[model samples]
Target: MAATAATLALDVASCLSHRWSWLLFALPLLGVASIGLFRLLKLPLGVQPGSVVEDVRNDDRVPPALAPAALVGTFFTVLGGGSAGATATSLAMASSAASGLGRAFGLAPRGAKAHRLVHRGWTAACGMAAACSALYGAPLAGTLFALELVRFDGAVARRLPILLGASFVAWLVAMPLAGGYALPAAAAPDPSWQVAALCVLVGLACAAAGTVFGWALRALRRAFVRSPAHPALVVAAGGAVVSVLVFAFGWQRFEGSGLTLVYAAFDGTSEPFDFAVKALLTTVTLGFGFKGGEVMPSLCIGALLGASFAALLGVDPSFAAAMGSVAFFAAAARCPLAAVLLAAETFGWAVAPWAALAVFPAYMGSTDVGMFGRGLTGRLSRAKRTARDKRRREKER
Candidate 1:
């Protein structure tokens, strides 16, 4: 409910922001640093804010005040035309709600040993499910998404009902406000072995794109971190670079969430280069410390990529876009099941079987680094460390 309301508020802010272009310059400049102004000293405007990436891997209990701070920050970020989408903000706010509630009521279960899995995990999962359901208008996928994320935690299984109820409630509340997504009539690919095989190839292509996306992100991370300048300075520089890219390359197609362009791809409006431009701008925004999630951007990229090359793959554009949409996210997130189900809910079940083919290859070949850092990369490293620790213990014994 809170997530939905905040999003609506953000929408209004975005609508109002267009009337005053100077806000674009003023907001991003003040962004995180303005938090410093709260104190009398007026320190170098360096009191930074928080986001999903910072809290998801940390304390199970988050401060209550985080919710308001994030909500206001997101509104301004979107208003400023920063290339961020809503996923990160939703997750962060959800974390705050969950953490705050747990701490407020002293709801610790199974002691500190299970802090991450019990008190924090349950709340975060429900919060995210509700937020996602509100954004995507698919209750099943939204619920499944949150459950899938916490599969590693055994405690979540017994509390599944609570998560489901919360998610459904969120969907119901958000439905009227979001109104849902609807694409115009377009050609659909007939079910056939040839088409399925082509989808497999499309998935492979998306995985390749994921690889390049990962590389660019790493390169930029290295460049930005290696620099000695203040983070705010780097972020401002990044904002400037994104603005130049948008104007210089005529990449208005890459603005906002890029969902409009994604919808247009199915109808042959967005061109092939739209994917490249959107990806570049999105990575730039993230690298520079903007607040947003990568899910929408990934979907946009996949849709454009699939539509552009569908004819080359000898398939229908709509079908290709559908395949591209799921496969790209699956590859990037390394969650084939969630990716396939998300498509099933969005595009219908028929695409799932075919999308599975693309999803499998992409999952296997996609970059180890994922959008939210919740992929096999971290799991594998953790597993390896555990094994190495076991060996060391044995040697000591």
Candidate 2:
């Protein structure tokens, strides 16, 4: 009997030694830290400034002036050519979190408030990394992103100080390396009642558009993942499809990520063809498993669509595009605060009013899909309310 008991104990120990067996406690920290680091360093991952933005106002500077057309043709040959640090950077950060940090550091993964804080900090790190990398000049954006996107629980709010600390650290690291596309030091555009109304409209349109984008991409991805065709064949077919589209449409809009096109849209240099080709090309790239982020491509599509609508509405295209960008993200991800912070970070304070205006409707319109299963109740409201209600009902019972 003693021998059997000993044998059982030994078996339990052996089973617990497997790496994945520890995941119930380790996974959360890994998830958090990797995301944190990804947000910290992902900004400098694209085409250089002035080179990508087509500032028609400065058309004399051949490169910036011709960036629109040249980008279409030239971007394909380059490595990591687009302004796409957000998704890649964040993914890398998440990977880091998952890789070894949690285990190496013996961090807590799941449990009560204090334990959750440690994990939350790690997860929030991704948002910080993203903010630092994407906005660089604006650390607040990174911090808010952590809160808006990563927190998801009111209790995590207690860790705000820690998140802010990481964001500040990330910002300090980012500033020197941020190069030309650093956060513009200007204020956001003034909140015109006209702009606010326009933002509402843009938000609604983006909600519908974002839902379509999410569903379409999922369909395409499902088709690719399930197809009996070889992976290489699938990729080659995708590349060929993109090539054909580029050739037929002309490269002014449908290359990688369409950052060039997005920048062009901001500069008022994009044509309708640019929008169409980019939208089609992006869907194809994601479908083929190129390993990229969708936020920018989706933003590009929304901006173009918004710009087109703005022209009809007699509103400013840049303003409308800004709102559309965030609105689409909010709808797609159900991340309203992150979407708003992102708008402010990328543009300026002026963007906040419009972003806020757009976020609500977009969030309302968003379909129930997200990159990581982020839900609409958002991080802060979901858990606490449920927990409180449960306790209350239990007490009554």
Candidate 3:
């Protein structure tokens, strides 16, 4: 139910954004107004998926107003042509709804606080799975995503069946309402040794690009945080810059979620610098306090990057683009399993092996901390600490 409701609301917002898309002249004004609204309501500028996942992992309470605030803020941001995606907003909404339902049903029975926290975490993970399933139209990938988000543990393992069921049910409900997000079908390329070697190179390049993107985003976010200017003024300046980029610099193609650019890449119509330009626009949009998620923009960047590489390597553009899309996202989000599953689901199983070849290298090569606030290095460090603590406790005993 939570997933269905959030999907409906997001679809409506998307439709309204498309309907008013011709009002390009009003973009700056809308951007300013959108930030102003968030400020007035005392809401966070961006309800990032990473933050929400972290909150769930820590068993933090979801404030009652946050879900609705995210939805409204996302609506205004999208309507204003912010270079962002709605996936995080939907995730926030659905997770909050699930939290509320859990509280209502007393799923956290009278027991140790740890038990209640675990139950809360389970519900939140289920909600995340449901939302991802609806948005991506791949239940297994969505389930894996939620599992990855929470850093799969023994407790989560026990709840896997519940999470899987919720994800499929949400997809079923969402299919009739908003339809699955289907990309343009591309022909599978022959998996030759040469293609596999080039795929490794593509993966390395995408990992480098992903690292640069993450660094730039964090730097810009720091600058925004340290700026002494009023929030509205800062946001308005960002809007003006976006306006200049679109109208003056002829970068109108990089606006919104950049899904059009994704399609263009598959059609072999993308420019050489489409990935770089889209990355810059997305960083500025989010760093300047525009509300939305980075998932779609990351996919767009990956598609463009892959398509450009295809031209240089003489490989199939569609296949390369598809590989790039999943590989880059895997590096950026630190979710190789989910990315691999997503590739299999969206492009067919034939592309899965090649995607894995690309994805694992990208995951290993990426130097950035990742958009999710941590990476494999952090996880390893935490595990080491846990082991050390356990050994110390045993010695004391």
Candidate 4:
């Protein structure tokens, strides 16, 4: 059995080594184009209408000209109160572009076999690199995210090489973007064991915040589907509410992706309430019709809340903010592995263990309900069916 397994692994590795897989190259182009297109279309319209373009040019999934929608959505998220980012949409586009490009090639076997082996792999690689580069200011996090989140078969040996190659290529492409990423120039944590412990507590708080965020999105979905409110109006209302809350709390930190606020939270730059309020605003923003990505804003909120908790605990704000960012991401995305990698990549080795440690409770405390639907355990369709069955049984009784 051992020999057979080794042989199989070798076979898989050999197959993966083939350069016949040229689809990976197409991924970055799609990613850059998709994001660009999402921005371009929206710029002229002055409104974000998120939709997939059915038209195509060659193998490209999202043309640069049509990427304005995603950008506009992101703008609303930052300037307004929409609680989303470029990651989700970009992932979707990457997957679509891969599949579309694969179909155009017509070189592989048709049907499910081709789709599974080629298109899926290509798209997965693209998403991996995009997520890694965008989240941690490099391609590593996105690669890990794609491998961990999308690739379920652990024993599949060939996946690693593809992932590494994709990540490297993406990093190379992004190197022009202000030396990869321009992290906020901020003070380092003062030496204190107490600061580390505070990070753990901040992690816990982030877990709680994740739960609240989950519940808020759920509530919004319920109301939106059930209510007579217009979708655009509902989204607009949420934005207005966020504006009002920002004014009331004097927390501009709550606005947009909250990156600036997140940086400030490191040194107690913003009030704790500011973080809490931004969390509320993002949840409400996304709960309505505003479409974007949720990761960045959530990071900002978690950092602020964590810093506040650290202050309350008499620990370092910087440490707390760092922990909060990772913990909340883990809880919200249900991707602890990705979250830790993001933390490590974002802050380097200094905080990797702490980030990993915080992810557990944050996962535990998080209710699993996220923008994707439910918590980590079940699919949305399955959960809905289960709920329906329970209702039926109750009615029969």
Name the top TM-score candidate: 3
Residues forming the 10-long window of minimal summed lDDT in candidate 3: 108-117
* Residue range 140-210, candidate 1, lDDT tens digits: 77777666555435565467787778778887877777633333233446778778777778788899998
State the local distance difference test value for candidate 3.
0.77
Give the alpha carbon lDDT tens digit for every residue of 1-397 in model 2: 1111222222232234233323223222322332233234442211121111111111111121221222211222112121122342232333233223443555434442244445423432443333433333545665564454443345445656755765666556545554313221223556577767777887888777777766776677778667787544664566556555545544523443455555666655666545555656666655554334455566777677656656766676777666766787678656677778777777876668777888888888777565434463643367689999999999999
Off by over 4 Å in 2: 1-86, 94-99, 109-136, 151-158, 179-193, 378-397
User: Cα RMSD for candidate 3?
Assistant: 3.0
Backbone clash total for model 2 is 19
Per-model RMSD to reference: 3.8, 17.3, 3.0, 13.1
lDDT of 3 by residue, 209-263 (tens): 9999888877777677677887677777887777677667777667667777888
- When sorted by lDDT, best at the front, the candidate numbers are 3, 1, 4, 2
Candidate ordering by TM-score (highest first): 3, 1, 4, 2
CA lDDT, every model vs. true structure: 0.66, 0.50, 0.77, 0.55
What TM-score would every model get versus the actual structure? 0.85, 0.66, 0.90, 0.70
**Superposition-based RMSD of candidate 1 using all C-alpha atoms, in angstroms:** 3.8
- Clashes found in each candidate (C-alpha, N, C closer than 3 A): 0, 19, 0, 22
Candidate 2 vs candidate 4, TM-score winner? 4
Q: Where does model 1 exceed 4 Å of error?
A: 16-59, 109-111, 114-119, 179-188, 218-227, 377-385, 392-397
